[model samples]
Target: MKVWKSVVSAALVSVLLAGCGSNAGTDNEQNEVKAGSTVNLKVFVAQPRLKEHYDKYIEQFKAKEKADKNIEVNVQLEMPPADNAPQILKTRLASNDAPDVFALHAVNEIPPFSKAGYLEDLSNQPFVDKLLDSVKPSVTDASGKVVAVPLETLSWGYLYNKDIFKEQGLEVPTTLTEMKAVVEKLKAAGITPFELSYKEAWVPQLFLPLTVGALTQTEHKDFVEKMNKDEASFSDMKALFDVFDLVNANGTDKALEVGADDGAAAYATGKAAMWIQGPWYAETILKSNPDVNFGVAPMPLNDNPDDTKINLSTSTSLAVSSSSKNKEVALDFVNYILDDKDSSAFYEALKFNPVAKVHTFKSFPWVDDALKYVNEGKAYQDPKIPQAVKDESGKALQGYYSGQLNQQQVIDALDKAWKSYNKVNK
Candidate 1:
């Protein structure tokens, strides 16, 4: 499933490390280390929110490596802001200053990075066989080469406060019409209908996957392929404005000033009944207010009940840079992420969904809430939309919300972006 393909973008490569060129390692840096030698490994990831958990895991890996191999591994973790990470990483890779290890959205990033000869082929790694069947495809390239370690396998949708829903006697809506009714009832009962954080282009841009996934899977089956071929237009799916307009009209005020972190705090505190977000932020939400009773539900995209399916996919994944001087140590760390004995606790501590067979922890209630739809086959794999197109959609939607553009202008922008992307990619 392409669910997690482009969900989270790749992280930045620290400019401070630019002095350490891609070929910085000596001839002896190739993993056959002498006893008591020290190896420095630079690691980068997109989610700065999970730094604490990652730090703990790296410490454990360090201690274990010292004990088992008589070698010291110095791991430098780099986490830049998510909004600009992808562009920075692109520049880093182009300059041959790639990190030893980094996180990327598996499906969307792997192919391009692999074509650029920037990714190591992990198809033969020990952890490849241990991945869950459902998640294997996300990290596998067209040649069946598994290029990354899949981390987050998400069954996500909008988050709703169970307490508020129950208190207001509201059921999860399965269509846009029902969703509108739910909004009115929530407003009547003195609760904000939605939590909107449009300050970040990526936040408002999430509507693309939620709406396009449902549409392509059912109503507009050929949409992505046609768009890729320049035979289709965004005007075909203009109905997306329905949910966009509805939520924008009823959500908490001053949305353009609010970012995801603040929006999570607002959602956790019950300032709004629903938030159009994925479970990837559950860690941040629970940290802000542990007592918040929340559950995941499909975002209603249209009047058709079938279009309200949950989004099931993978998010961030770990990969070793093929150009790294310390390939051996980098691969070891990637394998360590899926270690049979330590992985369950690691994933659970991060509140990430299980992505490998070694994961044995019980999932949170919200995960199960989303799984209820997945079990019923009421979920769709994320469509393979071009990253440039997705980026354009997010920026265009942000403009639409701020009154700088209208629906037609947004549609025209997306169509133009798609054609430009096709020209370059071809």
Candidate 2:
């Protein structure tokens, strides 16, 4: 488990794991469920908000398995709290208590999990051919093995109130200058320019992927690789603060006290004209206010319009555990996740963008808004930044918001986190 331990440490330097076995099981084992036997399959996901959707899907899968294979599956579906999920999952993996099938952020988690031989190779699965070409690379490991099922094909930046923008006679900004003007206009019209949700570090941490993706794809080419090698510094990307500062300064009041759900409520109720969040929370926001007219747009990172681009990514994906005794049933369940007949409905129910060729449901307006950028070639793949660095940025941004740390301190913290990640990973 030394390699698994290193993966966890490199990705989360702050969260330590006890060492265990690096391998889950040998590939020589023929893992399958006996016909007519009841199998207990464990399925873990980081999204607790979509428990109902998953429950329904699992029931469907159970019925399908019973009818097709004469096998009964009692799925133990686990949806843990988001903040503690990564730590909990790492602990479970290190202790050799891995789930049969689990969900992870494809680009961030697949590499390490595959390197540790925790993920079963899924390249030859039926769902592989069903995946869209755009999302294939996301689920593929460094060695080119398809290791996961793409679940959330994402095109995101900032979620904005379309109706508010219309009422204020403001259009989505295309550059830093236009964005500043839009902020001022919203403020002058007695509207909060942004929704700041800092109680959960991950919410504020959204800036890292959005900011880093856009800049690295355009002006800051090779920055991610350089940072990974400890050859670059966040000090060089100080332009990020131009928007981060404006967002924090113009956001709603009592931001530090507000968590993501509360922030969604405020945004849905028009407390702010815009929120720097992804469409993944649209379901939550609609729950708060179903009529909220939201749209997604690329955040303007700099004066160059070319620097503003949507983030195209497969954010969440499903993978089978190689160590599972019931790999047959687990892989069957994973393949069924993208079943042509049911996948579109499931993705539609979850308000997620389609990732597979089988998904034909029309996406929400906000998703379409973001996809317009993707369709027009104004999008960049989400950069592969260490999870530890993203976590550090979230904590650092919270301090930046509280005036406990200045811009330089935040930059220094990120640089240090990247260096620590490189050390452990190397």
Candidate 3:
């Protein structure tokens, strides 16, 4: 058995594979080593609740490594509490005890790691050619650099209970007006209409991407640019606020009383009829109650007839660590997760939409529909913004939810933070 399959470096360059090096002996020679040296790889991850997603894949990788190269791969999946992963990672890096590979949320976050000289450019990884064009931007820098492998493509929607819809005699609400009506219907039927976890604060930022989605569709394709330039504010979200009033209208305050995990529980238990969440919640929902019927729909358009924000754009990406000693391995790993059938299957099992177009899903029509969302010109990714603004805005929303700040106060906080972000990020 060939332990390490020889990777002949081609023109693509996501990782600097040895075969591509001009003087690294020959590809075949470089693929192997003497009888018994240890070639171990350590990985760090910040994505919580994804232990199962990586555990199995790492097993496959390890099996291949041992069979092909007499190499022993030591993989450690570390998901610091979601809130603390970055801080822990920074602390570890400072101590020079950081894992060779790690996880990050977006490209802007990647730049900081890259600037610290901790990542390898992934433009030429083996799987690069297999990615769907729609997902390319998720893992890319402004200069077209593929700094990391994009593991999944995500979209936001109301993860709702079909059972509740049936019990309430409600169909999928086609528009924001319709959704509001549905919310009222659910409330009258004694079901809490929405699940919101304002304690975590980041819950509302989910609305930001979707709100901007609507804004882009209606009167301002440059809303993101304006936000980035600090010339605009979340104040433009008044119409979207209508959805919030509808959501919280009927004592959904229980949502704010608990953390996100419990809020998810509230919905999963059939207490709450709807939850506007990313695909990440699928696992917990299934584990808690596989019998519950659920469906996903993009955020509905604003109820006001004159409103124009029709698109709801949400996405996720992956970036490579600039500090890997095994750039080839890192790139190969990224490719497998992004595009390979087996790897994509693993992710599909994890409930994330694969970024590659290759994994044709004949069973789940919804997955296919989500992929076509961008092609239909109905949705898009937000223009890259600064982390500070994202964080502070999330904090502001949390404050508003807790009544610690009024709507105006939230807007003021967001406006000031965004202006500051523009100065530093730009």
Candidate 4:
């Protein structure tokens, strides 16, 4: 999910031929020529790791579009690098000449683009009917403009080696104290109970939510929407540092000694008993050994043992360019991939939870419980601050991860970033 490939932040654009995509003779003739000799459909994505899925989808799309006598589809794919996608997409969108379809890393990216009239409004579009009610909000603008289609969702949680649990005769901690005790117990057994990497810098900062979820008992499931209204403040982010204190108390920085990739590797090899990661950890850890028995659970609420709530509340989204001369065709292509029925196979291949009518929690049992929880009126989207705030947060966390700042300093920096970033747009 976070590892999706090359995009700048939401600032992206793509020039279209006069008739880049339209029927040879149709009322929407403006879009009729996208495929003159060949209709070129350029797309941007975040998950390059999921290329196989896109390649297959493209092949199918090409076949279907070519079957039509009037239009042809050419698929050009690109993704943003691992870090700073929000930054990259922002740059591209500002450049004016960008891609036809691109991924929106978060709902926040869509607003500025929507304000700029850069994304197509699909609220009343046919594809809007096919998405799950739960997924639609992530793509809609404040004006309720549907700038993108909901693809799949990514949830966050703590993943532990079930085998390790059994070996230690430890039950999954349901209470806050027990959770920390579990960490302590594992450490006493000469095991690092958690995995963390400061090199990527954002790693530990990202995990702060696990603690926040535990602390609030998941009361702030709408943290994003609330933050959007200027009601929330990152300056009050002492909650975040409290979460990191667990990592510090446990002296788990040994894992931080490694890079993000290697820290996950350590977990895969059984050197670490627990990990705070999202579903992507499945693929990352599996690379070493798919057989590693891991169990997924919501991050402890307020560290509450029995509180089994907190939504892994966000997803990367897919959207069409407003400049597309082939509006109808582009919409059709996006709908073909994201609509309920088609999205089942699409979600399976992409390994994300389906947010479309076609997806079932059962289809992704690994992530099902989390998605089910989200659909059942739980989960919260990540706070989508302005580009400035986001980069500031990332940089601040990077500093935290690298031990460049002490705990209080980390919180202060986030407060500064959030305020400064929000100030510009305000």
Cα TM-score per model: 0.92, 0.93, 0.81, 0.80
Model 1, global lDDT: 0.83
Best by TM-score: 2
lDDT of 1 at 153: 84
Which is the winner by TM-score between candidate 2 and candidate 4? 2
Query: Model 4 over residues 35-61: C-alpha lDDT tens digits?
Result: 445666778886666677788887877
Model 4 residue runs over 4 Å out of place are 1-29, 34-36, 208-235, 248-265, 301-308, 325-329, 339-342, 371-387
**C-alpha RMSD between model 1 and the true structure:** 5.1
- Between candidates 2 and 3, the one scoring higher on TM-score is 2
Q: Which pairs clash (backbone N, Cα, C closer than 3 Å) in model 2?
A: 1-21, 1-22
Give per-residue CA lDDT, model 2, range 1-426, as digits (tens).
000112333543322221314345453287466679899999999898889999999999999999998999999999986666776776676666789998888877786667666788899999999988878988999999999998888888999998999998998999989999999998898888999888887887888888888888767898998887888899878877888898988988887799888898899999998999988888889999999999999999888998899988787898887778778889889999899899899889899888888889887788778778988999999889877777677778888878887898888888887888777566
Q: Order the candidates by TM-score, highest first — what do you get?
A: 2, 1, 3, 4
lDDT, candidate 1, 128-218, per-residue tens = 9889998998998877789899888888879999999999899999998999999999999989999999787778878988878989877
The local lDDT score (0 to 100) that residue 90 gets in candidate 4 is 56
Report residue 86 deviation for candidate 3 (angstroms): 4.3
Runs in model 2 with CA error above 4 Å? 1-22
Q: State the TM-score for model 4.
A: 0.80
Task: For candidate 4, give the lDDT of residue 2.
Answer: 33
